[model samples]
Target: MPITRRSAMTLPSLLAAPALAQPTRPIRMLMGFPPGGPTDFVGRLTANGLQDQIGQTIVFENRPGANSVLAAEAVARAAADGHTLLFASNSLAMNASAYARLPYDPTTSFAPIAMVATSPNVLWCGTSQPWHSLDQLVAAAKAQPGTLGYASTGNGGNGHFGGETLRQALGIDISHIPYRGTAPALLDVIAGRVPLMMQTMVGAIGPYRENQLRPLVVFGPNRAPELPDVPTLKELGHEVPDSGVWFGVLAPAGTPPPFVMRVSHALQAMLEKPESRAQLASQASVPAYLGPDDFAARIRTDVTNWADVARRAGIRPE
Candidate 1:
């Protein structure tokens, strides 16, 4: 059974696998928001699920600033090997309309992987504030006009635009007060520095439970189980806008289609797992899974619609 060097070389070649079957490198997932935020909560859940499903190491990096534009730009410029991913949200869609120019194009700079989860925004006010319901808040704003002010995480953010959408829908005059992030905004609200704010349900859930913030209404299609007594904007006799925070995965544009499809399928399978769904639900994130094409379409639609909203609201670039 003596084998020559030529025979040994042939055996090794026979056992070798194709390039596509080889293991992929570790992935880096970038988040636009700082830690301890809703997006972070959802991002970690997704990253873990994807790591398990893909059998690859996934590192989550938080590059918080300018409402995720910085992180978006970083991901857009990364190698399109399906290794670098951006944990994008509706904020990116808003940025498309809010900013005159971005380092990266939202629609064309990245390939959509899959839509992960979504959570409705809640209309909340300081517990000590006068208004307890949406009607009362609107009436008070009508009486005070420019005197009423609201706070948001930042300029041209979901909370800012959500408040603007409500104002336009109801014809109210309220000034906006933009904060560096949600923490300061919530602090000001609880301290009565501002009267109202429209924030994500997940972010508001803690303050609501602690009785520091009052939930006036949920801005989604259905009532949030966490705040069941609160009615939706539609139920309160106002046409609700199609606006809410959504989390999705995206890789740099020009990534191979096969690689994109592989990530998409892995994400779909991960979200379908019961444990994954439960983890997301516990964070106030509703499971909303969309494939690559549909996810891309949703982002496009959001950017276009938010552009219209920002235009009507006279929200110019910052």
Candidate 2:
């Protein structure tokens, strides 16, 4: 039978019917950090909002190791279905420069979804430390040179990079002490094992509030709302602005465009919720929602920027 215009239109609709009829499944959000860390904390929070809006359970799977390479590789290899997602942070962007070789291409291995939020890295000193402010700390580091030790969550983490940047910018020689994680580093700082550390605002807030650690400066363009008393690095004559960690979502490359938009829209809707905003604020994080294009651009910019920092600091991954 010859197809008429009406039948042709109906044929197109028939082809689309199966796609529309497919049942939605639970989305798996892969996080590269262990539970209770900043990345995992934000991942779980965002997952809750996503689940609420998408009407599907968002399961969080932790595949932490090798500076998040394990999780990144897993997500990179996963099918480009909307059901699997990756919750990533600055580490993913930084790894491009930090590691000499990686199994996955950070820029092209995944489809950028949305930038979730940015948080400052708090410049903290042990409560027992003599330095009262950032200026005092810088002066002390200059005076002591390599004797002044600063702790980091790990060798290639944001905290380490932040500390390294400060060292290079201020022309100081503070020693870098690597810890397994931020909690252990914070504990060591509180015990006066190390004099200083650059920690995420989420991890440092409680210690700062309790006076276990003194926040001297925040690596943000402006003072964070939770730490109004603390000055920014820029305020202290450092040109460094907003060199902190950011969290974002990504899907394996080649995921259908509709699926990407669906997840992105769900995240944007979640960010608009009053409760979500409140929860993020309570952790000293400001919610930032950057769509796919903008988020990918930011990632590229950061990778280049941190690469320079790594070069200046003479850091070479082992």
Candidate 3:
């Protein structure tokens, strides 16, 4: 027998439907970076919070390569049933301008859930280096242009562009030495092979605390709470402001609107927890809660902002 329209329009039956039908299944969160990086660390923390809040297991899958393009593609191609999500970061948005072509469109290949957190990047030098502050470092770089080399995760990474932006902004010349990852680059800096590098406050915190690295200036409007003594680039006489890194959640494009909203609400609840807030603060990250539309707007703004930075720095990635 054909179902009647009056029966299908019953509000009680529709209202009884589960918001997340697969509530018991393990949710897969994909990370573009490797295990020990900030992205992985924060992703795991977020998963833990969500697991406790949503009463489901959240698993993290690491697919590290090609500047996180592999993971982004995997998430973009995954089933849009809300079980699979991407722990997207600045790399995804920056790649839009860094790479000439990508397997997926960053802006449209995924549904924005909520921005997890944001942290400033710090310009740090090896402890053994003579320069102690931004002013001193710029003075030395100006005296010997191209002699002071810095290391970054890659040519088109945030650290790379941040370094280049500083060079252009301060009218100094410094050679950039790109590495496969921040770990190796940080090692090089510690060994004095590379004079300096810009890294996330989270990543630099341990090294700085251990006395292996000396922070020069953070690339943000205000100093990082974890490193309150460190001055911002703008505070050091540079006009650069609000240069930081962020992490967010994304589902594959075409994901059901109901599922996306469910996931977003779950994440918002998790972020509101006191434990989650403490975890974020411990990593020097500020929690940023934005709904789908607002998060999408942020992505667009970031793409436009970083595209200009890349263009000005003459960064054309292959």
Candidate of highest TM-score = 2
In order of lDDT, best first, we have 1, 2, 3
| Shift of residue 16 alpha carbon in model 2, Å | 14
Backbone Cα, N, C clashes tallied per candidate: 0, 0, 0
Instruction: Report each candidate's C-alpha RMSD, comma-separated, in the order given.
Output: 8.7, 7.3, 6.8
Candidate 1, residues 1-318, lDDT tens digits: the string is 123365445433422334442237878999988898899999999999988866679999999888899999999999887679999998888898888889988889999988988888888899899888888988898988899888888888888888888989889999889888889899999999888888988777778778999988888688876787989988877775666788999999998776666667667767778898888878777878887899999889888888888989999987
Query: Model 1: clashing residue pairs?
Result: none
Error of 1 at 110 (Å): 0.9
Off by over 4 Å in 2: 1-23
**Candidate 2 lDDT by residue in tens digits, 123-200:** 888889898887788788777778988898888788888988888778888988999988888999999988888898
TM-score of 2: 0.91
Q: Whole-model lDDT for model 2 versus the true structure?
A: 0.82
Model 3: how far is 112 from its true place, Å? 0.3
Q: Compose the digit string of candidate 3's lDDT tens values, residues 180-260.
A: 887899999999988999888877777877899998888978788887888988887787635578888999998877666
By TM-score, rank the candidates, best first. Answer: 2, 1, 3
Residue pairs clashing in model 2 are none
Task: Identify the superior model by TM-score, candidate 1 or candidate 3.
Answer: 1
